[model samples]
Target: MEAPGGPGAPPMWGPGRKMGFGAALGSRSKGWYTVADGNLSEVFFPFLDHVALHELRFFVSAAGAPPVDDSGDGQHSISWISPGVPAFRVETTHHEYRLTKDFFSDPEENAVLIAATFTPELPDLRLYMQASAHWEPGTDGNFGSVIDTHPPALLLQQQDIWICVVGPFSRANVGYFRSSDVHIDLTDADGHLTYTYDRAGPGNVSAGAEIGIRAGAFQLAIGFAHSRADAEEVARTALQKGAGAVRQAFERAWRAQPEIPPALGKVSGDDGMLARASFAFLHCLEDKSHAGAFIAAPAAPWGETNHDGNHVYHLVWPRDLCRIATALLDAGDSDAALRAFRHLQSQQRTDGGWHQNWTLDGTPHWQSTELDQIALPILLAWRLGVAGCLDHDPYPIMVRPAAQFIIREGPLTTLDRWEDAGGLSPSTLAACIAALIVAAEFAHDAGEHVAANHLRAVADYWNDRVEAWCSLPSGQYIRLGSDPDRRPTEGSTAPEFLELVRYGLRRPKDDRVLRSLQGVDTSLKVSLPAGPSWRRYAGDTYGEQSRLAGTDRRAGPALLFDGTSCGRAGANT
Candidate 1:
């Protein structure tokens, strides 16, 4: 019988959202894996943009009881195996049993290894491994098969790309997702994978295996390659090397970099928060095929029910890249920051403005152009140039055109930093004014004094006129728009107003800036028990909302799993 969704249809957003990820050093690894709700989730291969495996989760059940997925039915927790590396140790607990998995990427191959241990050694306990494969960026139109090898493996393929799941299995089977998968049947009736199939179609497909946990432990590896044989070989070799050896190499590789300062090693309430942030940031740069092309996040935001399209956040934003470069500079990773600058140079459009976002290979994914993206790179060049990180000047090729692009088509942005609403924006203007001023410094270094003078002149003009262009009659900055008098009837406040002070166009203690902050806090602040947090804006609609009374989607009064806009509410940071 076909499943309720459809026969071999695409999978839903998540077993759960990504909690953390594990990737080896950028120089040695091409594979990255994420831990979500304590389950191995979203294995990316070759490139961070391509998701080869949707999930590889462990299930355990007594002989006649239904299986409990590590993701959904267990209490989950995760932590890095080391402070400096992205490798993770995830633990999930239940009344019946407990599972602990140490996840690490194989440094020498495109593969990930997990060493797992189950607790209490129950005699009737059976451990099953199930892998849902996507095989490409979007999770659709994939094929799966069971390979009868010595140790046995499951292979998923999409055109030329292949991914193999290698491990010790007493028996293996392949099946269509949800409808006829052995994993589902195991959960539905008995705790055994009895309804085994040999192959699944060119739709949502997965593979299942009954793994024998000897003394409460087992090992598995997920590997990727252009050919099926090579993929299996890579995984087999990784598993043969053992997770202990592979994990040591992974941690040692990351620790080879400069040590993080003791102050940054831990935070007061959230120990390891800063260190984990650094590791997560560096994880995005681990793509060997595209050095320094870091995606914003290795996640699929709002992915719970929205799985049909390729709207994941695993793409590069030049604005985010520039900020990351600045942070890298602060963290003493000059090499990574410089590499990012070079990658930005490669992605710069002929018109000099970058697309709103792009894939790691310099392919434009979204066609919109944000002025902040055009300006931020020039700012980065100036920072890098000032720090002597740039061996050669960037004026002629990068900074010059980028500065000119801003002058030609901006301080008025086609899209704001949020990729919403056009026209005058406080933050966009701040970026343009700052970028032109820095670009002027590069222009002078390049012996183009006239260009330098003109750039500074434009920056000064924007700096002086920003208040007139953005402030409402009451002195608060409007979230967006060209005219100050045309403020929206509903109150509006954005964190974007702080950019004027951040970019040095305004003083922190200035009366106007303080008034704007007051307005923002009064309008957007949510006083939670933990602390005060601000919403994106007064009328932001980015998070969960109630379903409308009659329509499939719209603003309404009842909260629903569907993220369709129901009403404006605080989706805080």
Candidate 2:
């Protein structure tokens, strides 16, 4: 979903469903859902109440059933689900029962349309909704409801955004009752409402409203507003415009997305579906806010740690962001790339180091002294600027410090990308060498010829150091230069040689490069479903703890998906 205004605007759909953050619509601010106890979460106008889109459902009677029944028959089964158009489809093979529910939100600000198109049309269909506020203390807590007295039953979140649940308003059969209460009198009075936390409400009953949907199509539109009256007005307009118009409006709004950044237009058939889904999942992972960067996963941002007592991937990792940004650029979207660049720039340390991950506000967390984080950004920015993916300069503050830091840390002992507090590794030095060339070019473009020369000279020296110390007589490479203990021809060393060639640091036929690749293939390679996998390092005591010496321990012989020979997917990582 595009922002309320137009194209060139940020998309709103996010990883709401994947993360179970109650963010089904995945709006940067507006959409959220609940997965607790199989209950539909609340979607709140984020700017208004700490409300969520929580209460939403569809009730259909196949053949015959009450419009307000409490239970569902197996007859109402969904035959298909789609991420894009046609949204969700329900069909019954035994009879002529079929209906498709299309759920989508507005192009501007906030609004969600849960529309249904029926085949063999059921005139007694009901669009069930609760005018429930997730917030407590009612209006003071940025929550309120507009029920029976309005054009459509509506729920408001502090007047900021309102959920206008549209239904057949002319029907007087609707009344407000407790959501969970077994016995309660129905209130058809001027004012009636309910509140339920989509996450943790047991007896959380909601006073709801229902609209009788006519034959062809119907909708329950959740709209954003700043006041109760405005919400009521939006409900009025939506009722008048109807579900068909709302769907059409949204279609027009989202029409250009598949064309921009991705177009995925070139791929056809199942390949296209997979490609689109991949792009959509990545986009869903995005926070969609102007200041937000693409987070690593479904987890919410800003947390220092996850449930397992380790750092969460939900926050931005500079190295990870650089790679993600490059992919976006490759896919023809420089906006995400540029944003990733800016976000990483904001996290660079004064000493030219980066934290392992960072929150949205740029706060450092899980600090790791990895060299790539320092070097990768410099390379990414320079590449983007040169490739024309970057519209603005990212080097005025990035190149020099990165070059200096890599120079300072290249020959020193530092944590490897594997997070081990081991001494210097060749891959770290190799990556720095690549980044240095980019930085030198950036320096040259800025008229800093002397600094450029110094960077180039240092890069050459590091390249020489790597070749001199890490090379073994077996035509293979090692991780540390000074010691051979705990060394078994590291699988991680295999890529350094290839990288050296890619960045112009080494010749393709260079003996050391050939030796390393040949050695890794012969020593670290293992069979995998797709192809071969490599171990983190030779003598890699990955899963078991005791590698040096222990009677009760054994090294893991697992193959990881990250192209490593460790067991499972992330044994060494």
- TM-scores, in order shown? 0.90, 0.58
Candidate 2: TM-score? Answer: 0.58
Candidate 2 lDDT tens digits, 205-258 = 233444444456666666556666665566556656665665565455434454
- Among the numbered candidates, top lDDT falls to 1
Off by over 4 Å in 1: 1-7, 11-16, 26-28, 120-123, 135-140, 261-273, 276-280, 484-491, 528-530, 546-573
Q: Evaluate residue 360 in candidate 2 and report its C-alpha lDDT on the 0 to 100 scale.
A: 57
**Whole-model Cα lDDT of every candidate shown, in order:** 0.75, 0.50
Tens digit per residue, CA lDDT, model 1, 22-115: 6777555688888776777788777888777888877776667777766667887887676657878888888878889888888888888889
Q: How far is candidate 2 from the true structure (C-alpha RMSD, Å)?
A: 11.3
Q: At residue 336, give the lDDT of candidate 1.
A: 83
List where candidate 2 sits over 4 angstroms from the true fold. Answer: 1-99, 117-146, 149-217, 224-240, 257-292, 297-315, 361-370, 389-393, 409-430, 461-573
